[model samples]
Target chain A: MKYKSQKVAYWFFAFSMLLLILQIIYGFIMAFAHLGYDNLHPVIAFNTARAVHTNLLVVWLLSGFMGAAYYIIPEEAEYELVNVKLAYIQLITLALVGVTAVIGYHFNYWEGRKFLEIPRPLDWLVVANVLTFLGIILTTLFKGKKRTTTSLVLTMGLVFAALLYLPGMIWFDNQTMDSFFRWWVVHLWVEGVWELIMGGILAFLLIKITGVDREVIEKWLYVIVGLTFISGILGTGHHYYYIGVGKVWLIVGGIFSALEPLAFLAMALFAIAMYRKGEKKHPNKIALSWTLGTAIVSFVGAGLLGLAHTLPQVNMYTHGTLVTAMHGHLAFWGAYGMIVLAFISYSLPNLTGRKLYDSNRGVLAFWLSNIGMLGMTVAFGVAGVAQVYLERRVGLEFGDVQKEIQVHFLILIICATMFTTGIGLFIAEFIRYGQPTDEALIAATDHDA
Target chain B: MLSKSQAKVFFLGGTMVTFVIFLGLSWNSLSKEVPKRTHEENLTAQVVAGKHIWEKNNCMGCHTILGEGAYYAPELTKVYERRGEAYIKVALMTKTPWQPRGRQMVAYGMSDKDASDVVAFLKWIGEIDLNGFPPKPDLKK
Candidate 1:
C-alpha cells in the first residue's frame, strides 16, 4: 500500500473473492444434489459441478497467492512492482482462462485429470500467465534495496509451482504414468511448495502484527521450511499407495506423510510462541485473530487430520472414500483458505486506510466460517467412516452406501450455510472499505510512522 | 537457539537433501517400478486413441481409474473385467440418463467408436499389475 503499484493487488483480491463466491455456489449445487434434489443434474450435473467447485477453489487460492505476492514483495523488497501494467494484464488473462475452463467443464470439454483438468491448450496459456507473474515478482525483488528470506521463500514457491505444472502437461499413453506425473503437480503443490508460500505470508504477518523483530520471525520461517521439505517431499508417496506404483511406496508414503504433521505442528508452535513473546499491542486485533487462527487451525486441519489416514493401514480403507473428502475439506480450509483470509485481513486496512478492523461483522465472519467448516468436516468424517464400514467392510453396493449417507448431506448443507454466511460478511466488509486511493497511501505511511 | 546464518545454511542443506531424495525416488519409479508393470508392447494405437477419448470426455471426474478420482460413481479400474466390454458399451450408448436412486451418471452421448475406445483404455489399465491395492478384507474374521 505504500507504493502506487501495489494497488493492482486490490483488483486481484477482488477477482479472488468473485471466484470464491462462485465456488461456494457450486458447493451448494453438489450438496443439494447429494440430498436427492438433482434438479440441476440435467444442467450442471454432479461431475461438472464438482469440477467447477474444485477448479474454482484452486483458481481463487492461486489468485489470492498472486495478490499476496504483489502486496508483500514490494514492501519486503523495498521497491515498486517492475511493471504494474503487466500484472494487470496477467490478472485479466488468468480470469479469462479460468472462466473459459469452467465453462468448458459444463460442456465436457476438458481433460479428465483431476485438478489439472484444464485442457492442454489452456495449460499453455496458464504457463504463460504464471511466467509473467513470476517475472514481475522476481524483477522487483532483485532490483529492490533488500531481498529478505520472506520474499525469497514466497518467490521460490511460486517458481517451483510453475515448474511442477510441466510434468502434468506431458502426454503419457499409460494411465499409471499419467497418474504418477499428475501427483508431481497436485501432491507436490499442496504438501510441498505451497507450505513455503504459507510460511512466507505467515512470517510477514507475524512480524507486522506482533511487533517482533525480523530476525526472530525469519528464523522460525527456516524451521518451518526445513520441516516442510523433510517430510512433504516424500509425502508424495502417500498418494501412490493405491495407484499402480511400486509396493515400496506403501512404506515410504506412510512413514513420510505421517511425519508431515511435524511441520504444521512447528508452525502452530512458532506462531503461538511469537505471540506470547511479543507485545500484543497491534491495534488490528481481528487480523491478529486470523493470523493465530490460521496457525493453530492448520495444525489441526492439515496436520492432525492428514495424519489420521496417512498410515498405510488406515489409508487402505479410506483411500477415496468420504474420508479423503473429509481430510481435503479441512486441510485446504485450514491451511490455504484461512491463510488467505488472514493476509486479506492484515492488508485490507492498510491498502484502503480503513480502520474497519474492529467490526462485529469481521469477528463474526472469522468464528462462523471456521466453526461452520469444522462442522462440515465432522459431518464428512462420520459419513466417510460409515461408508468405509458399509461399502468396503460389509460389501454393500456403492449406490446403497450413498443412500445410507444421504442424511449427512443435510448436516453438510446446514454447516455450509453458516460457512457461506461468514464468507458473505467478510466480503461485505471488504466492499464497505471501498477502493484503494492516493490519500489512503499517504495515510498508510503516516500510520506506519 | 541457532543464529540466523546458521539456520539459513541448515535449511538450505535440508532442502537439497529432500529434493535429491525425491528426484532419486521418482527416477527409480520411472526406471525400475513402472517398467515392471508397464507392457509398452500392449499399448496399441487403438488404446492410445481410447486414452485420448477418455481424457477428452473427463471420465476421471466421476469414475475413478485406479482409485484416483471422485467416488460418487463406481471405480472404473476393473469395470471392463467386472462388466465386460459389451456391457460398458451398452451403458455408455444408452441415451436414457441412468439416474440411480443415489448418485446419477450423465450419459455423455458418446459415439460407438468413442465408447469402444474408452473400454479399450479401461481394459489396458486393468492389465497392469497394481500390487494388490484396494485390499479385500475378510469379513468373517
Candidate 2:
C-alpha cells in the first residue's frame, strides 16, 4: 500500500488463491477415493492426485510468501520496488512453471520424492524464477533508505530456502544418500527457514495491529529466531530416523524435534504478550483476529501436535501412518497457512482502500475455517490412531485396515466442506475488496503524511 | 529484557553454535555411520540403475522405502525379504494395478530390466543398518 509497486502483490495473491482452490479439489478427490469411489482411478490415480494436492499446497504457500515479501519489503525499506515490471514477469513465469509441473505429474513425468515431485527440467525453471524473485526483493531492500530487522529475517529465510533447493536437485544413485539430502530441502525449509519467514510476518502484523513499538516487537522476533535455530536446525534428524540412516539421528532427532514446539510456543506467547501490551485500538478487528488466531492455533497444531508423535517411541508406530497426515494437516494449516491468511487479511483492506473488516462474513470465514480444519485434524488423528492399532499393532492387512478406516473419511469430507466454505468466503471477501487502485495509494500516502 | 545489541549478539552466537552442531552431526553420519553400513562395495551398477528407475517411476509416491513415503502402500524396505525379486518382477509384468486382497499397486508397466533394478535398489536399502527404527512391535498377546 505504501508504494504503487506493492500492487503487484495482488496478482500473486490471486494466483495463490486459484491454486489453493485446485489443491482443495484434489483433496476432495483423494478423500472420495479413500471412500472406495475410485471412479477416477484410471485417469487421476490416487498417487497422481496426491502429488498434485501436496505440490499445489507447497506452490500456493510459496506464492503467498512471495506476495507477503512484495507487500512488506517496500514498506519496511521505505521505498518502492526497484523494478515492478520484473516482479510481474517473475510472477507469470512462476505460475507457468508451477502449472507445467503439476500437469506433468499426471503423465508420471516426475521424480518420486515427497514434497519435491517437480521434474529436474522444471526444477531448473523454479531456480530461475526464485532467483528473479530474490533479485527484486534483495535489490529493493539494499537500495531502500533503511532495512528493518523484520525485513532482514524474512530475506534470510528466502535466501536459505533458495539455497536448500539445491540438495534436492542433486542426482544421487544411492537411495539412502538421496533421501538424506532430500530432507535437507523439505525438513529444513518447513522447520528451519520457514519459521523465520513466519516469525518475520508475525512480527510485522503484530507491530501494525497491536500498535506496538518496533523495538518491542523486534525483540521478540529475536527470541523466536533463537529458539528456532536452537531446535529447528537439528530437528531435520526427525525425518532421518527410518531412512536407512545411522542411529545417532534417533537421539539427535528425538531430543531436538521435541524442542521444536518451544519456538512455536514462543511465537504464541510473543503475539499475545504484544496484544496485551498494546492500546487495543486498531479498528481492523478482522486482521487482529487472524493475527492472534495464527499464534494460538499454530501453537496447538504445529507445536503440541508435532510434539505428540515426535518422540522415537511414538514415531515407531506412527511414522508414515495417518498419524503423519494428522500432524501435517494441522501443522501446515496452523503455521504457514494461517499466517498467510493473516497477511492477506491485514493487507487487503489497505491495498484496496476498503474498510470491510468488521463484516459478519469476515468473522464467519475465520471461525469456519479454523473450526473445520480442527475437525479435520481430529478426524485424521482418530483414523490414524485406529490405523496404527489395527495395521501396525494388530498386524491386520493394509487393505483391511484401510477399509476399516473408510468411515473416518466421511467425517473428513464433511469437515473439509466446512473448511472449503470458509475459504470460499475468504476469497469472496478478497473479490469484494476489488483491485488496488490509485485512490488507495493516495489514501495510504496521505495517512502516512 | 535484553537490549537490542545484546539480543543481536546472542542470536548470532546461538546461530553459530547451532550450525556447528549441525555440521558435526552431518559429518558423523556421512563419515562414520553411512560408511559403516552403506557398504559402498555392495552397491553394484545394477543397484545404482535400479535406484534411478525407482525415482523415475515415482514409486515412493505410494510405497514407502524405510518408512519414508505415503503409507497407502506397504513398506518396500523389506520387500526383498518378504517377497523375492522373481515375484516382484511378475507383479510388475502382470500390471494387475490392484490386488483384491490388500492395498492396490498401480501398474507402472516397468520393463523387466527396470523391475530387476528396482528390486536390487530395495535390497540395497534393506541391507543398511537403520539403527533400530520401526522397532519390533510387541505382538505377544
Candidate 3:
C-alpha cells in the first residue's frame, strides 16, 4: 500500500491537465481569429489553432486517464501494479510521442485526417504504450486475488480501443479507403470502446462513493456495456452518411446513432439511482457533484446534439458547420473530460495521502466549465443554424455567411476564457492543497464500505 | 441502484423506448427521400472514361466533391463552377505546383486524360439531385 500510487498519479494527471489548458487557450484564440468575419490574427490561423485544440484535448485526457488507471486498477485487483517500471516507460514513451506528434502537426507532417494526427512512426510509439498498458492490466487481472467484472470490462475496453486505432492508422494507396478507416478510429472509440471504459469506470467509482449494492450495480453495468457496443457500431454510420456512401448508410447511421443516446441515458439514470439508493453517504461531496454532473452532461452533449445531426435531414443543414464543433466541444469535454477529472479527484487524495483537499474548488471548476460549455454550444449552434439558413436556403454567399457568424464565435471565445480560468483554479487546488482533512478521509473510507 | 427488481423493469423500459424511437426515425428517413440520377444521365463516353480514371485514382482522397473527401485538400464539387473542364484539365496536367503547399494529387502527375477523368467524376457527383446530399461548406473547419 505504501509503494506510490497517489503522489505519482497526480503528476501524470497534472501533466495532462496542463495539455488541456493549452487546448482551451488555443481553442479560444482560434475562435477569436475567426470571429466577426475577419481574422483577429492571421499568423495563428483557424486551421492551425484547430489542430492544437484537437491534439491537446486527446493527449491530455489520455495522460490523466492513464494516471488514474494505474491507481484504480491496482487497488481493485488488491495488489501492487504488475510492472511499475513499464508504467514509467509508458509515461515516458507517451510524453515523447505526444511532443513529436504536436511538432509534426505544426509542420504539416500529418496524414491529413483530423483525429489520426500523429504520422505512422509516432503512431507506432502510441501503440506500444497501449499494448504495454494492456499487458500490465491483464497480468494484474489474472494474478489478482480479486477479479471484479468492472475491471475486466475496463481493460477490455482499453484493448479494443487500441485495436480500433490500429486499423485507422494504416496507410492505404486508396484515399477514400484511408479516409473511411480514419474515421473508424475517431468515431469507433468515442462512440464504441471508450464508452465501455466510461461505463465500467463510472460504475466502479459510483460503488466506491455511494456504497450501492454491488449486485444491483453489476446488473446495470451489463446493460450499459450491451447498449454501448450495440449502439456504438451503428453510430459509425452517422459519419458514413456523407462520405460518398449510399443511402443505406444514412438509414443505418440515423437509426443506430439515435439508439446511442439510450446507453448514455442509461448511465445517467443508473448514476442517479445509485446516489438516491445509497446507504453510506459519499464523503467528497464536490467529487460526487462532478461525477453526477459529468454523467448528465455526457448524456446531453454526446446524446442530444449527436441525435440532432444523425438525421440526414438535419445533417443536411448542420454537417460541416460550427454545429458539429458545437457538438464535439461539449461531447468530448463533457464525457471524457469530466470522466477523467473525476478519476483525478477520486484518486488524488488516496495517492497523496494528504488530508484536507478542498473539494469545493473542484465543484466550482465543474460548474464553471459546465456553464462555459453551455454558452459555447448554444451560441455556436445558433450561428450554425442561421448559417444553414443563409447559405443553404436563402442563397447568401458562403463568405458573407462566415462573416455573419463571427459575432457568435466571439461569444464562444469569451466563454472558453471563463472555462480556462475555472480549470486553472481547479489545477491550483489540485497542486497546492489537494490532501483533505482527516474527517474527509474517514468519510471517504466509511462511504466506501 | 434500483431495487434489484425495480432496476430490471426500468432498464427494460428505457431500452425498448430508445430502440423504438430510433427505428421509427430511420424508417421515416428512408421513406421520405428519393434520389434522381439525372445529372449522371447525360454523359459522353469521354466524360465516362474520365469518371473511370477518377475512380481508379481514388480522387476523393484529396478532393472532396460535395463535402465528402479528406479536408487536407479543397472541395471539388464547385470546381467545374469555379474553373470549368478546360482549366481543370490544364491545371491537373500542368505542374504549377506551389512547392510550399503542394497538393496530394499533384504528385501523382496526372495526365490530361486522367485530369479529364477526375473532372468528369467531380461533375457526376456534383449533379446528384438528392434533397440534402451536398451540405453547405462548413466554415468552422
Candidate 4:
C-alpha cells in the first residue's frame, strides 16, 4: 500500500468475492439438478444456472486479475495509478454489465454461447470498461520510474486478453465458424494469455514472499511464458478437433496439447525451486500455502488431468461427457480460482495494515477448500468415466447413464458443501480485516514485503 | 546458463512464430476446409434461423451440439438423423418442460417454424466432417 491509489484494489477483490458466493450457489443448483432434483427447473433452470455459474466465474476472475494489477503495478513501476477515479468508474461499470448479463440470462436475453454468453450490446460496454481499466494501468506503468519485466508481462497479458475478445464478437452465420473463433476468446484466454497473467502474478508473489532476486525469477518467467505460447497458442486445436474442423487438427491438437502440460510442470517446479532457493521466508504462512498450492495443483489439474484425455484417441470416447467437466472444474479452480485467492491472501495485510496472517481459520480454510475441490474433482472423474463407458462405450442411452451416475452428484454436493464452507471461512476472514486506510502505507525501505 | 535477455527473446520469438502459424492454419481452415466439409451450400436460411434459436435459448447450456455444450442432455449434433424431426419438434414445441427419462429441459414452447429451424441447424451440424468424432461405440454388443 505504498500508494493511495492502491486502495481501489480492495474494493475489486471484495466485489469478486461477493460474486464468488453467488457463483457457488448456482453450481449447487446444477449439481442437484444432475442428481435428478430439478425442483428449481422452472425458475433457475439448468441452462440459466449453468450460464450464471460460468459467467460469474469469468467476471469474478477478471475482477480479481484487475485487482492484482492495481496492487502490483504501482509498487513495481514506482507510481500511483494515473486516474484513480476512472479506475473506480471502470469497476462500477464492470459490475453493472456483469449484473445485467446474469439477470438477463434468467429472462432468456442472451447470446447463449458457452462462455461468451453476454449479449452483443453489453459486450460493447465490457469492451469500453476494459479499455478504461487498461488505459489507467498502461498510463501508470509508462509514467512511472521503472518498467520491470513483471509489470510488462502482466500488462501484456491484459492487453492481449482485450484484443482476443474481438474474435468471439464477430458475426458468423456458420455455427462451425462461430465456434471456431469463440475458442479464440475462451480457450486462448484461459490456456494462452491467462497463463501469462498467472505467471506474472506468480513471479511477483515469489519475489515478495521469498525475497528472491527479481532478475533470477523474471528470467524463468520468460521461459515459462515462452513454453506457454509455444504450446498453448496452437493448443486451441484441441477444442477444434471435433468442431467440424479438418483432420489436420486431430494430429496438431493431440501433439501440442500434450505439450501444454510441460508449461504447467515448469511452473510448478519453478515455484518450488524458487521457494527452496530463497533464504528469507515471509511470515504470511497462509499466503505461502496458497501460492505454493496454486502452482502444484494447477500442474495436477490442468497438466496431468488435461493430458489424460487430450489425446485424440481418448477424447473420441470422452468428448462431450462429464470428463470435460472433470478437467474443467480443477483446471479453473487450480489455475485461476486459487491464484486469485492466493493474491488476495498475500495483499490483504498490506492493504488493511492488519497482520492477521497465520490464524487457524486461514489454514483450515485453505485445506478444507482444497480437499473439498479435490473430492469434487474425483466425484466428477468417476461419474464422467462411467458416463463414457456406459453411454459411449456400451451404447446406453444418455438418460439411463445419467441415472446410473446420479449418486455421484450426491458426492459432488457434499464435497461442494465443504468447498463452500472453506470459501465462506476465507470470506469471513476477509471481512474481519475491514477496509484499507492511508495510514497503512509504509516507507518503501521499511515495509516487510 | 540462459541470460535474462535471451529468455526474453525466447518468449518473444516463440510467441511470434506460433501465433503466425496459428493464424495461417485458421485462415486455411475457414477459407478452404470448413466450407467443403460443412457443405456451405446446405446452410439454408432456415438453418441459420435455427442457429439463432439455438443461441437465443442457450441450448448449449444443457444439450451439446457438435459436442461443445453442457452434458446435461444428449449431444444433439446428430439428433436429426438419430431421432427424426417430429420428435425434436415435440420436445421443442411442447408447452411444458420436456422431461426425457428424468432430466428436465426448458420448454421453449417454440413455434413450428422455430422448431424446424433448430432441426435444420442440427442437420447442418450433423453433416460436418468431424474427422471421426462422436466415434462409434467400440464395445457395444
Candidate 5:
C-alpha cells in the first residue's frame, strides 16, 4: 500500500467476506431444499433463499470490485483518494442497504426480477450509492498525475455499469418488455462491462506479479475489452431468443453469442502469454495461482460451458432447466468471484505489511475451493442434462423429474461443503493478516515488481 | 501487428458501432415487433393487476415465466392454457399451502378478484409469440 486511503479497501474486502459466507449459507439452504429437506419452508422458503443467495453474490462482488477500484486507482493515477471519509460512509450505506434488502426477502418485500430482486425504492438508493462511488473514483483519477489506460478502462466500466442499472428499474406491465430491459442490466453487466473491470484488474495484477511492462499489458487490455464489447453487446440476443422478441435475434444472438467465448479464450491466453514472457517472477505464488486460475477457469466455465448450450437449438431444451444452473455456477465463480478473491490475495500481504506469501494453507485454499467448485459444477451439469432429457425431452412431469434428480443435490451439498471449507481457510488467513496500517505503506510504488 | 493506438481505436470504435446497433435493434423490437407479437392491445387493467400480484408475491423467484427465473417449479408461461383458469384459481385462492406432489408453495390465499387477475395475466402471457420456445419433446415415446 503506497497511499493512506488505500487502507479503506481492506474494510470493503472484509465486508465482502462476510456477505460471501452468508451467500454460501443461503446456497446450502436451497441445495438442501432440493434434496427434500425443505424444513425451512414456512420460515425461509426456496424462493426467498434463492433470492438471498443470488443477490448476496452480486453485492459481495460489487463490494469487492469497489475495493479493487479504491486500491488500484490511487496507485495507477498517482494520487490519493479525494475523500476517504465519504468512501467509508459509502461503505456503511452499502452494507445497510444490502442487509435491509436481504432481511426484506424473508418477508417477500422484493421486485421478483431474479438478480434485480432489490425493491424499486431501494433501487434508487443503490443508484445514489453507486453515483457517490463513481464520483470519488473519477475525482481521484482526474486530479492525479496521469490518466493511464488501465485506470480509464476500469473507470469506464464502473460508469457504464451504473448507467446500465437504470434500464432494469423501469416498470413494465408486459413481462416481455420487463424481461427485455432487465437483460440490459443483468446480461450486459456479467458478459459486458464486468469483463472490462475484470480485464483492467487482470492487467494490473499481471504487471505487478509477473513484472510485465505496463505498456505491453495495457495494450492487450484494449484488445481484450474490444473483443468483449464486439461479442458481448450483440450477445444479449441469447436471452432474447426465447423471450417474446423477433426472429432476427435468433440469427444475431446465435452468431454473436457463439463468439462470446472468444473473449474468454483471449483473456486466458493473454494471461498465460504475459506470465511466460515476464523475466521477473514475484514471490507471491498464491496470488499468481489465483490470477492464472481465474483466467483459465473462466474460459472453461464461461466460454466452453456456455458454448455447450448457447445455440438456439440446444437452448430450446435447456432454457429454464437446471442446465442453466450448471453454466451459471461456474461462470459467476470463475469470472467474477475468483477475480475478487485473487485481488484480495494479491493485495492482502501489501496492505497488512505481512509477507505471509509462503503459507501452505493459502495454496490449499486456492485448490480446494476451485476443485470443489468444479465438482459441484459437474454435479449440476449431470443433473441438468438428466433434467433436460427427462423433463424436456421425455415429457416427464417437472416434479417427477426433480424427484429423480434429488440424488445429485446430495452430491452438490457434499461438494459445496468442501468449497465452504476452503473459503473458511481463506477467511482464516484473511483474519490472521491482521489489519492495514500506515507502517505497511512503502515509500516507492514502483518497487512492486 | 496491432499497436497501442490501433488497439485503443478498436476498443472505442467497436464499442460505439455495436452499441448503436444494439440500441437500434432494441428500439425496433420494442416499437414494432413487441406490440404485434405480444398483442399489446389485450393488456387490460386486470392483466396488469395480475402482473402486480405476481411481482408482489415474487412468484418468479420460484416458478419461471418465459424460461426466466428460478427453475424450482414448473414453467408457468403456458399455465393458463395447461391448467385452465379454475385450476389456477384454486392454487391461488387456497387457504393452505399448495404443495404439488409434496413440494410446497406459499399459500397467498388471494381474493377471488386477485386470482382472476392473475389468471388474466397468465392468459395474456400464454398468447405472446416466443418464436417456438419450450420446444416439444421429439424423442418422447
Candidate 6:
C-alpha cells in the first residue's frame, strides 16, 4: 500500500489475479463433482460453485481494471492519483466484499444469473466502491498540465463500465421483462462496455510501451470505441434470441454481435501498425506482446464464438449446450480477463522496483499460461461439439450423455489441470519476480517519500 | 487506359472467386426452414397445450429438445417412440416413481391432464420426419 514513486495500482492488479487463481481451482473441482448419481449434489453443488466462480471473476476483473486504471491513468495524465490511500481502502473493501459474497453464495443466497450472482446488498456496496474508485481516477485526470491522449479514452471506458450497472437493477414482474433487463447488465457489459475498457487499456499499453505517436494512438482508440459501441449495443440482441423475446430481436442481436469481432480484428491491426511504426525500442517487450496478444486472442475466442451462437439458426443447434459453456469459458478468460492479467504482469515488477520478471523463467511462465488456456479452449470446444451430437442430434439420456463423453470429460479435466498448473506457474513466477532487491530496500529506507 | 481497365477485370475475377468461397462456407451454416413435418390436427391442440405447460414451468431451462436449451434431462422429441403416449403420461404423473437410474426422466410434479397434454405434444413431435438427423435423446432404460 505504501510504495514510493510507483503508482500503488499494481497491488490491486495482483490481488485480482489471486482471485482468478481461486476461480480456476473451483472450476476444476466443479467439473469432477458432476460425476454424481441420483438426485444428489454436494453442498458446494454445481449451482453454488458456479455462483462463486463467476462472481469472483467479475470482482477480480474489476480489481484488475481499477489497478490498471490507477497505474496508467496517473502516468497518462502525467500526475499521481489524487488520494492513493482512498484507493487502497477501496481495494481492501473490495476484497472483504468478495469474501462476504462467496460465503453467502454457499448458503444459497444468490441471484440465478450465470455471472451476475452477487446478492442485492453486495451489489450496492460494489456499485459504491466502483463510484469511489472512478471518482479518484477522474479527479487525478482533472487538472493535469501535459496529459497524454490515452487518458481520455481510459476515463471514458471506466465511467461507462460503472454507469452501465444501472439497467441491471431494474427487473420487472414477468420473466420476459426480467430477462431483457438482466441482459442489459450481462450482455452489454461483456460486449458493450467491457470492450471499451479493453480498447482503452490496450491502446494505452501500446502507446506507452511502443512509444507510438499520441495522435495515431488516439485515433485508434476512437475507432475502437466507436466500433465497440455500435457493434456491441446491437450485439445484446444475441442473448435475446431464445429468452421468449419477439422475432425481430433475433435479427438485430445476430447481426450486431456477429459484427462485433471486426472491431477486435481492427484493434489487432492497429496494434501491429503501432509496433511497426514505433520510434524507441520499448524497455518492457513482454508487456507489449501481452497487451497485443490479449486483444487478438479475445477476438478469436470470444468474438468468433459469439458470432457462431448469435445466428438464430446456429444457436438453434448450440444453445445452452456445452458449446455455450465452451464459448463462455474461453471468452471470459481470454478477452477482458487476459487484458487484466496483462496489466498485473506489467505493473507488479515495475511497482516492486525488482528487475526479476525479465528472465527466462518468467517468459516460460507466460507461455505456459497462454498455451494451457489455449488447450483448455480447444478441449472444451471439441467436447462441447461431441456433446451437441450425442444429446441433441442423437437420442441419448442426459446422464447417459455424460457417460458417452467420459473420454471428453477426462480430456477437459486434463485441460483444467493443465490450466490450473499454468496458473500455479504464473503465481510462482510473479512471487519470484516481485521480491524486492537489497538495493531497492536500502533505497526505500533512505528515500521514504 | 487499356492496361488499368484490364487490371480492373482481373481484380473483379479474383473478387468473384473469393466471394464464391465465402458463400460456399456460409451456405452450409445459414438458416433454412425446418423440412415440413407431418402435422396431425388431432394432436396440434394437445401439443400446443403441452407447450403451455413447458413455458409455464420453465422446463426448457432444465431440458432440451432438438439441440436447444439446458441439458439436465433427456430430450422429449422421441419420447412417444420410446414409451407409448399412455406410458409417458403415466410416468409423468406417477405418484410412486422409480429412482432415475442412468438416463431417466424424472416424474414431473404434474397432474393427470398435464401429463396427457405433454404426451400429446411429444406424440406430435415424434410423428415428424427427422430427415437425416439422429434420434432424440431418450430416457434410456
DockQ winner among the candidates?
A: 4
Per residue, candidate 5 scores C-alpha lDDT tens digits across A1-449 of 38889999999999999999999999999999889889999999999999999999999999999999999999888899999999999999999999999999999899888899999999999999999999999999999998999999999999999999999999998889999999999999999999999999999899998888899999999999999999999999999998898999989899999999999999999999999999987888889999999999999999999989989989999999888999999999999999999999999988888888779999999989998999999999999999999988899889999999999999999999999999999999999999998778573243473
lDDT of 6 by residue, A71-121 (tens): 777666666678878988988988988899888776656655445657668
Worst 10 residues of 4 chain A by lDDT: A440-449
Q: lDDT (CA) for every model shown? A: 0.87, 0.86, 0.68, 0.93, 0.93, 0.65
Candidates 1 and 2 compared: the better one by lDDT is 1
The chain B TM-scores of all candidates, as shown, are 0.89, 0.89, 0.56, 0.97, 0.97, 0.59
What DockQ does each prediction reach against the true complex? 0.67, 0.62, 0.12, 0.89, 0.86, 0.09
Tens-digit lDDT track for model 4 on B48-111?
Answer: 9988898999998998978888989899888888899899899999997668898887877889
lDDT of residue A260 for candidate 1: 94
Each prediction's number of clashing residue pairs: 0, 0, 13, 0, 0, 4
lDDT of 3 by residue, A98-209 (tens): 8787766554455545656566777888888888888887887788778776786678778888898887766543333444577778887888778878777788789888
Off by over 4 Å in 1: A446-449
Would you estimate the TM-scores of all the predictions?
A: 0.97, 0.97, 0.80, 0.99, 0.99, 0.76
Say which prediction, candidate 1 or candidate 3, comes out ahead on lDDT: 1
What are the runs in model 5 whose C-alpha is more than 4 Å off? A443-449
Ranking of all candidate structures by their lDDT, best first: 5, 4, 1, 2, 3, 6
DockQ (model 3, Cα): 0.12
Measured on C-alpha atoms, candidate 5 has an lDDT of 0.93
Q: Considering DockQ, which of the candidate structures 1 and 2 is the better prediction for this target?
A: 1
Residue A322, candidate 4: C-alpha displacement in angstroms: 0.4
Q: Determine which window of 10 residues in candidate 5 chain A has minimal summed lDDT.
A: A440-449
Window of ten residues with lowest summed lDDT in model 2 chain B:
B132-141
How does residue A247 of candidate 2 score in lDDT? Answer: 77
Position A278, candidate 1: lDDT: 81
Tens-digit per-residue lDDT, A1-449, candidate 4 = 38888999999999999999999999999999999888998889899999999999999999999999999999999899999999999999999999999999999999889999999999999999999999999999989999999999999999999999999999899999999999999999999999999999999999999888999999999999999999999989999898887988888899999999999999999999999998987889999999999999999999999999999989888899999999999999999999999999998988888989999999999999999999999999999999999988898999999999999999999999999999999999999999998777663233344
